[model samples]
Target: MMGKTWIAAAICAAAIFSVFPESRAQQAPASPSVDAPELAALGSYGIGVADLEFIDKGRADPLQGADVPRVADRHISVKLWYPAAAKGGGTRYRTGLPGETGSDVPFEVPGLATPGAAMAKGRFPLVILAHGYSNTPEVLSWLGENLASKGYVVLAPAFRDPPITIRTPAARAGPLTSRPLDIAFVAAEAQRRAKAGEGLLAAADGARTALIGYSMGGYGVLTAAGAPLDPGLGGATRGVLAPFVAGGPKADTLKVADVKAVVAISPASNLYGTPLWAAPGVAAIRAPTLFIVGSQDHVVGYETGVRRLFDQEVHAPRYLLTFREAAHSIALIGAPPAMRESFWDFDWFEDAVWRKDRLMAVQAHFITAFLDRNVKGEAAKSSYLDGLVPNSNDGKWPNAPTGRYAGFSPGAPASTIWKGFQPSRVSGMNFEFRPGEP
Candidate 1:
């Protein structure tokens, strides 16, 4: 009987292992040994990081837990990554698990949190990064650090959202409703601080602002860029998202005129099988936007959620980049060391069909090109975005580079290669662009 019981346990383990083959395969290599080359900034200047705390007094605690009393004022923490003249060794940044106050565990980054890193000369544009639901800002350090390295100051604000442990869709409403407001307040404060010559962000160029939001953050950026919430969406929120209902007081505070562009990654547009933004509401988003999503995303349904949002925005010039067979979480930095012990935890930072590092590399390339062209007014960069192929793999380089394609050779005839991508690196991606209807 004991032998039979042991046999059953072994069978159960085998079944579990077979079900998550990709996770097991990825976990085999120790994370410390993997090279996250994609995380490195492409610019010549070193990166520096600093934390700023802002107070939104008299604001209701949107995520006040049912078990806890409400707090009148909301305290927001913002982490800023920027270009610096002084070089320093990379350091581990503090991060917390879901719902925790401060992280005891370290999330490694390639930048120093040195206040005296010596700000590089010239005014850099501001890029505010909003993370997914229940996620800390440092998980996106890869983007923040990389953008900073490329002469852009990136600010990631930690939202007072629901804990990751919460599984119910209803529990997400308060934080969901408050996300846009959080971004608006954070951006305004960062701009104010920069203009006032306050602290580390004194060199920040607030006139040029771009928002990059992932998952729920994506929803927030779209709304903040002027996409209105459907007046009827209040029913789906169970009154928790009432403030963001169209024509409500909160909805009036959503738009930010300074935003030059937005990038939404796996945004939660249709949460819990309900539409949050109607077609007319989405059409109001006039800012130039980019959408990055997985074709097989179940969390945010691809057809009805992301693709729908992309197709309805007929007013703005938009681009949609799809990863074939990939799921949500395409823009994450890396799997946190603390999450390595479990498959579900590790998956938060990885994709089943693609390497996270490579994905980030492609993201860095296109995003750099897009933002540089749109926000920085670098008209020359437009060459990289024009004439893109429908499918990444369809773009070919017969004269493939021995190491890297180094982008197209000067004046090389247009081959099948996707704009800005090297040989063989563009597989499994679909990029499309549509200008506003005349």
Candidate 2:
């Protein structure tokens, strides 16, 4: 009888192991493809990375109510990437799924950044990066590291969001409030540190700052940039979010001052069958903004979600970049191989029709141009953002001389193809621009 019991246990163990092979071998997955668009290439500066922590004292604790402390300190973990002296070797980041406990997966990304490398001279623009729901900063290393190399101090804060799969509306209260508040707090702290000339951010140019967020992070950055929350949101959180609503006593606290630029990628809004921000709410955003979205994004309805928000923000000088047949997974890096073993994990980083690497590259390219034009005050970069053929497929590139690759489009009369893009590589996309009131 004991032998039979042991046999049954052995069978159960085998079944479990077979379902999750990584549990046994614990092997790292193959690195994602490195192929990138022309402008997605790394900049001249070497990259350096560091991890830091910050605490928001006496903040409301929505996750735990009467039973636990009503107000507790919020601990935020930040992964910072910045310009550094060129160094050998790269960094491999380890991360896990939203609610996964136990094993974390490791994947090496091909890059020039060296962990703990010396900082490069001179102050560079500050960029506050916020990730999506239940996501860690490590997942956004592609953007953080790439921008750092291009002469920016990039900080990505871990919001410690609840799992995306959580169905209860109350489960969202914590993130809905914490997302913007955390971004606002980090921006303020980083600027303060910059002014004081202290720590790794000493060389950061806080005055020339930009906010970039993906999905929920996009929602956070938009609100933090000045888009006020809907009054109805207060009731959803049982008045826990009342103070941060538009015109609320703490409304000012949610905004970052004089934001130079804003980037919202697949931003989440209108998730509750209603718009999170009204026309007046979004009109408050004065910074030049860029909105990127997948036209067919079912996760955050394209027409009802980001597109609606874009249309309402008529007062801001904004541009919308639409991926023809893509989906909500537009902003993340390619799924590491281990994640591909399961549909749930793989969906987090991949799109059904678009290649993740290509999506990332295109994003990096446009974001670079936008930030450079608005934040760095590079007038030359404006050409890259403006005067483009709206539909990429309609753009024309006359045949070039043999033995030479087709060059970037020069815009308008010379070539209709969007500038800085290889001829064959540009398609299935649309770009629109609207100027703010002068």
- Give one digit per residue, the lDDT tens place, for model 2 in 1-438: 999999999999999978674432221111223444445777788889888898889887676776542788889899899999785477677666642432444454444467889999999999999998867777777888878888999999988766544356766776777788899999999999999999999999999999999988998999999988988778666676788887789988989976899999989886556457644867788899999999999877788787887887878999999999998888876676677777777787879999776788888889999999999899998888898878989888675333435555566666777887777778899999988875
Give the residue spans of candidate 1 off by over 4 A: 1-41, 65-71, 99-115, 164-166, 232-243, 398-412
Candidate 2 has an lDDT of 0.80
lDDT of 1 by residue, 205-312 (tens): 888999999998998888888887876656544554467667777776777658888899898886665566754767887778889999999998799888988998
TM-scores for all candidates? 0.83, 0.88
The true-structure Cα RMSD of candidate 2 reads 7.9
Give the per-residue Cα lDDT of candidate 2 at 309. 76
